[model samples]
Each structure stands twice: as structure tokens, then as C-alpha cells.
Target: MRIEDKITTAFVLASGPFTDGSLWDAVSGRLGAAGAEVHAVTFSADPESHAGEVLRLIDSAAAPQVVLVGHDYGLHPLLAAARQRTGRVARIVHLDTAPPQDGDAPLALLPDPATQALLRDRPQALVPAPAPGEWARFGSTAGLTPEDLERLSALSEPCPGAVLTRPLRLTGALAAVPSSGILCTASGASIAGVQQLVSSGMPQFQALAEPSVGFFELATGHWPMLSCPEELTAALLLAAAGGGRRLTPAVTRPFHERPFVLDAAEAPRVRTGLVDLHLPAAEGPRPAVLLVHGGPLPRGLTPTPRDWPLYLGYARLLAGRGLVGAVLDHRLHGLSDYPTASEDLAEAVGLLRADPRVDPDRIALWFFSGAGLLLSPYLAAPAPWLRCVAATYPVLAPLPGWAGVDPAFDPAAALPMAGALPVVLTRAGLESPEIAATVAGFLDAADGCGAAVELVDAPHCRHGFDCSEPTEEARGAVRQAMEAVCAHLSGRVPIRD
Candidate 1:
């Protein structure tokens, strides 16, 4: 089938002043010739808001299926738009650009030190076109002809520094969307981080390397559209037609048929209070685990669909292992304080225990980050149904502003009452001093109380290992930690060092 037949509208988003609509003429022309409606957009200052603008453009086009093609900084807005409009985006094409992960800044992704310096100096302002010598160092690397270089330089506008520095916020919305990358292999070899992404088997680059997110290489430099337009166009068409190789399958699961609803009246402030249960296709009640996510809340943010890739992946993993996995979205800091979150968790436990498919006697709790604070009360009065508790890079101490929410927020304080409930704690070696101190204090208290606590140290990793692109060391540590948790739930506690 033709690419145009698959996508009704295609938006070609050009990178800031580095290139413009004219630079994409060759590529867009080819797409247009293939019978797809193409719209090329360029933004002025305050590029952070460009995503919204692109959304407006897509809405204005009113096409059922849309394809977004982004180059350089253009990829940022494209990602933002794709995240917000996941259902509408048919496919995404990254032209000689590294797909930005959550919390990545465009400036940080640049492999060139010179480019970094140029961006840092112009904070909250506009960066003028590069000088002739600088252009030769940066622009000419794209394998553009002298005349093409002159035209690009003439069309270059002042790029917003804010756009380079602002972090991209992702909510795993694009995980299901098919994406393709046209890598400029020649220029990528010279870029500092690109080589690592291409060679070092980095975890962050796993999404790009995955089979669902297909990639093609071009012999040209950074601007494949300018240096190798025909090949770039072909790559885009292939991606649109779903004809690219993928390394790994997208992380998704088809489990139980419907969502088990929670009473919002019970916890009114909770966001979409629902427990998504994933159960293995089996005959009897199975061992179950409640997956709790962490959040202190970002100030003034509205609630959206909960889409933590880590918990989702873990839920699927647990279900595949013949256990029922329950994911709960508790109240956040701003929506409701610690008390509400704890109440919601209690309610989730009740729901799980009441479910016919879950083995109430063999339930476990897995906590991440701030949600670990909620474990304090549970430890203070250990429940028989709760077989074990697992925490990953948790926040054991209470936040200053949230002291009133839970007076017994300190995990150390509850250690003496923990009794014989086995606890597994995964600590990141490079964690910040505050968190390290909290973990240390908790361990000391646990030891003093004779609580059965197991420590799994990820010495080389920082916090959020599951979310990060995994190095070999990080991958091994995560796997070991997961195995320990699974074993604990299965009535076999692995001997700890």
C-alpha cells in the first residue's frame, strides 16, 4: 500500500533557525507527489509552546490519521504533540535526530561541545546565525554544497535558547506509536554521544533500537533531507507504510478484559481511582502483588492518564509468571495529602483481597520512591495477608510540607513494629546524600529491631534504574532485584549478602 493511503495528513516540522521550510521542500515535495497532504511548520521564539501550535494545526487539518516528521529541535514539538494526541498520530519520522526521552533537553543531546557552548551562553534569549567559520565547522558537516550552505545560512533565524534547554516531558504515550529514524551515519560518527548510542548498547537508546521504532542509515551528514533528499524521502515512506525492521517488540500486554473500578466517593480527590488488574489465564486464585507508584506532585499540574512504563512492564511481567498484578494510582501530593494516599492504598488492598482470582493469603506490596513512605504504617502493624514488601530507591523520610499528612512518615520509626515481615530494599549507590542518609538510617533501625530485611545494592546506578536506558550493569542489577521480589512472593526468600 502507498504511504499516503496509510496517512491522510503529514506534518513536516523543520528544526529552528538551523533549517526552515525550504530545507524540507525536497522531502515534502516527494510526500506530496505520493498523494499525501503535507504541511511544513516553523516556529519563532518560545519554541516550548510550539507543540500546542502543532496540535492546533493538526486539529485544523482535521485529518483522521496524521504523520509527524521532525528534524533536530523539531523533534521536541513533534514528541510533545504526539504524546498529547496519541490516537491521531499514525507514525513519526525522526530525520537525523535522536528521539528525546523523558526529561531530555535538546542541548544535552547535542554531541558537539561547540554547539553546547553556543546554546548555554544565550539562555532565555535568541541565538543568531552562526558566523562563516563557525558555519563551516557546524553547518558544512551536513555535506551540503556551498550554494546550499549559503541558502541555509541566509534563511536561518535566531533560535530560542529556552527550546534547547527545556526538558521534554513524556508520559509513555508514544510507546504504542510506530516511529522511524533516518540516522545520518556519517555525521553521527563525529558526534560525541551519537557513537555511544550507536555502539555502546546504552539503555536509553533501546527504544530507537527496537524493531517497532525502525531505523535506516544515510551516508550523508546531519541534514539528510538537504544532502540525501531522495533516500530520506524513501525512508519516510517506508516507515509510513510500516516497512522497517525493529529490534524489540513494544511493551504492551492484553490481560484481563476490563478495568476494576474504585469508588471515587471513597477517595474523592484521587485521580481516576481505578485498580487495573492483570491476571494470568489460570484456573484458581493466584499469588498477587500490588504495584504502587511514587509521586510528590509537580506544582499546578492537572491529572492525566497514569502511564508509568515501569509499573506497566512489571505488571505484565508478574502476570506472565502466573501471578495476578494490580496497579494502583493513588492520590498525588497536591490532589490529596499522605493520608488520602494511604487510605486509597488500603482500599486497593481490600479490593485485591476480595477478588476471587487473587490469593488473599499470598499478597505482596511493591513500592517505588515517595510511595515507600506509605509502607511505614503497614510495617507498624504488619498484616498477615501481606507476605512481603519491596521498595526501590524509596523516599523513607517525610517531606517538610507534608508533615501533617502522616505524622508517622518515617520508615525508621516503624521498623521496631515490623515484626517478621520480610522487606527487600534496592538502593542506588550513586543516590543523593539525603536519600542515602534515609536508607542508611532505615537499615540501621531495621538491624537494631531484628527485622528480616534484605538489601540489594545497585552500586553503579542512580535512582530510577527501571526507567533509564539500561547499561549491562544496570540491567543485571534490575533483573536480580526483580528476581528477589518474585522469589519472596513465591515463599522462597533468596539468601542475602
Candidate 2:
């Protein structure tokens, strides 16, 4: 092959103990056929040091630009290596894998609930390989021959339990490197909604949603390397060539015809509070909606705009409908407790009301998931300017893990305070019991108080339906919920489809 026609050196990092790197042979072979030098790195028992080993291999080759490909658990080490040698890495490819954040563990990223439970209960030494039936659950075996299945099962090994439970420590270097994702659409479908991953307040999904990270989709199962190597290889080539499109289509509506203007400003006197404002182009003093995203897992992590793609999209949707949309980043879970969050929100409300572009009396509150906790107190004697509250799968009850920390965190307790303010509650039918129970109790209180409350059910959705999977049903639910919110704030009866 001519020098320029040759592809760059590619390193294929196979996922942990579920199977040997043999599945990657087809992909590697194809790359070699294309005149690319390919090297496949299998995981060692010590995942903690795997990244170092990969670096050593790259240094030995002295390749100027290396394409780092990670599948599933392999992404952990790949990310670590990329962070250390960002300049040498050409592109980071995540193949049917969840992107790792600064402090994430393999078990935490597992899509299968049962597997997570099993690993949680098992010994924290070396985790044994899954049984044959269990292995089959990872991906579809539709195209694999009997020999392929048997070979894969036999090649599987035990992974270190530490790798599954321990948090992956990473610097922000990977963000600077070009990254792409090859989503196994079938596997993604089997898991909870993708929007839920974001709405549930996971930092990893936030990283994946970066505009810099491009994505490609495959119709195969989780083990795309084994099920659809050709398609996966094609996507890798496109990604390596910097030509892949986003896996999730961009939200062009509302913003397409009437483009919205985005502006940023920090809250007055509050050092940590930053607000992103989206305004319609043809706006005067329009009714405004304050978008409050859910807090992080009660562990005290600060929330960034990356964590609120759904809300950001909604802000644009509101702008498309001629309303000013404001998204506020309140104090993080650990930095500020309930009191601080409420205070920050109040400050944000005041700022919006005072803005000349907003109609103070027509302002609305849109709370997402855990943010509902912050909304509870406001419900108890809402201000005249607070026209209505629209909550999407809010946590009305205290999280079990945080129950001991905040004794006064009951969302139901503050329900009686929602005197006459109209409330539009969007419930995810597939939400967990804790959230479902909170919604039930809150509704009962709202009914007794005779508050104007409207319940919109997203039967096939999960918690954070607004940001959950981008299935047709999920997207439809989000649109319907947002429409309902817009109507409620406008004093019109929400027309449900």
C-alpha cells in the first residue's frame, strides 16, 4: 500500500474477562487489510495498571498518532492512558461502552441491574465469570455460530472485583482529545432510557453529551465486536477520519425556524451561581420559565450544564414558543445542603423577575427529578410572580440514603403550602418505587388542598423521562410534557395527545 493510503496505527483494547480479545480479530484483520498496523491488547487481572502497560506498548512502537479503541470495561484503562498522553492519541473510540467520568467504576456503569446486584453481593476479590446463560444476556447471539459462542464462553476469564467496584480516577485531559462513540442500539434499548442516564444526574452521560464527541449507531447487541464487526469497523474508520455524526439527533425544532439567542451571566452577589439564559429573537417582556435541573447523587458533586441536556433543549423549546428560558446551576449536593439550594433558587427567581425582558407575574418554575426537593418549600406560599410549577418525575420524598442527613426533607410535607398555584406534574410510569410513592403522596395532598393540579403520565417512560432514552415514545413524552408546561403557565388547559 502507498504511504499516504495506509491507515494510522490502531490499538484495540478488549473488554475485561467476559471474553478474550479474539473477537477483535476480525476488526484488526480488516484494519491490517487496509494497510494499518493493528495491535490488540487484552485486559490483565490488574486493571489498575493496565493503562501503564498500554502506554509502554505505544512508546515501544513510537507511533506519532495512535487510534485508541476501547470496548466496555476496556474504556477505563483507555481513558486513563489517553489522559496521560493526549498529544499522542489521535482519537478515542468507545465501542458499545459508557464513557467514564473522573470517579466512576465498572460496576456503577453496568446496564444490567441483576449483574450489578450479584457483583455487589459477591466477594470483592476476583469476580468469577458469568454462567453460560448469564453470558448470553450481554448481547445477542443471532449471527454467531455454535463454535463462536463456545469459543467465546471458554475464553472468558475472571475479572478483578476491585476493577468493578473501585472508582476510575481521571484528569480532564480526555476531554481535549477527539472522542467518538459506537452505540450498540439494541443494547442501549434494553437498558433504561438514555435521557434517564442524564436526568438521573450521572456525570458520565454528561461527558458523553459533549458537542465535541461524535457518535455512530449499530443495530447489533452489546457485543458488537462479535455480532457486527464489519459495521463497527466502518464506524471506527469514519470516526478516525473525523466524519461521524451524533448518535442522538440534534434538537432542531423551535430553534430551527425562530432561532433563540443564548446568553450567560452570573447571579449577583453569588459566586457559585451561574445562569444560562435562552431568549426568543422576537421577544418583548415575555413570560419566563426558570429551569431547575436535578441535583447530583447526594454525594455533593457540582452540577454543570453538561448534566442538563434535556433542560437545555427545553429552554430552546420554550424560546421557540416565545418565552424566556433561564437555567440556573445551584450549589452542588455537598457544597450546599437544602437550605443553600433554596436560597440560590430564590436569588435566581429575583434576578429573572427583575430582568426587563421578563414578565414578573407570569414566571413559571420547571423542576426536574431531585430538584423537586428544592421546590417543596416554594410550593408552601408561592410568590405572586410564581404563576405555576411543572415538575418532571420529582423526588417528593427524601432519598433513603439522605434520610439520616436531612430530617426535614419530605416533599410531601410541603405540599399543603401549594395553595392556589397551578401545578403540572409529569410522572414516569416506569420510575422506581421511591419516586413513584413520593408522587402518589404529593398528589393526594394536592387533591385535598383543591390546588389546580394536572397529572401527565408518561406510561412507557422512566425517571428523568425528559432526558431519558431518545426512543420515539420517550421523545414524544418529553414534547407532550413540555407542551403541558407551556399551556399551564399560559393559563390554558393542556391538550393531551
Highest TM-score model number: 2
Instruction: Estimate, for each residue in 376-460, the C-alpha lDDT of model 1 and write its tens digit.
Output: 8889999888889999888787532121233456688998999999898989897755567778889989878899898888888
Structure candidate 2, residue pairs in collision:
193-469, 194-469, 195-467, 195-468, 195-469, 196-468, 300-334, 380-417
Tens digits of per-residue lDDT, candidate 2, 1-497, equal 44326456665555764665676888878777765667788766676688887887666654457888887677787777778888888888887665655665666445444555566577376666765556654544455656666667777887667777766787766778988877666553312244334444455355545666777878776676767777777777777777566434223331112211222221212122466668765446778788887764333353464234455677777777767778887754531255667788888888888888777778888888778877777777688778788888887765422211243455567667777777888888998765788788888877787877878887887765454355667666666767776775674322221
TM-score of each: 0.47, 0.55
For candidate 2, what is the TM-score? 0.55
lDDT of 2: 0.66
RMSD of 2: 11.6
The global Cα lDDT (0 to 1) of model 1 is 0.67
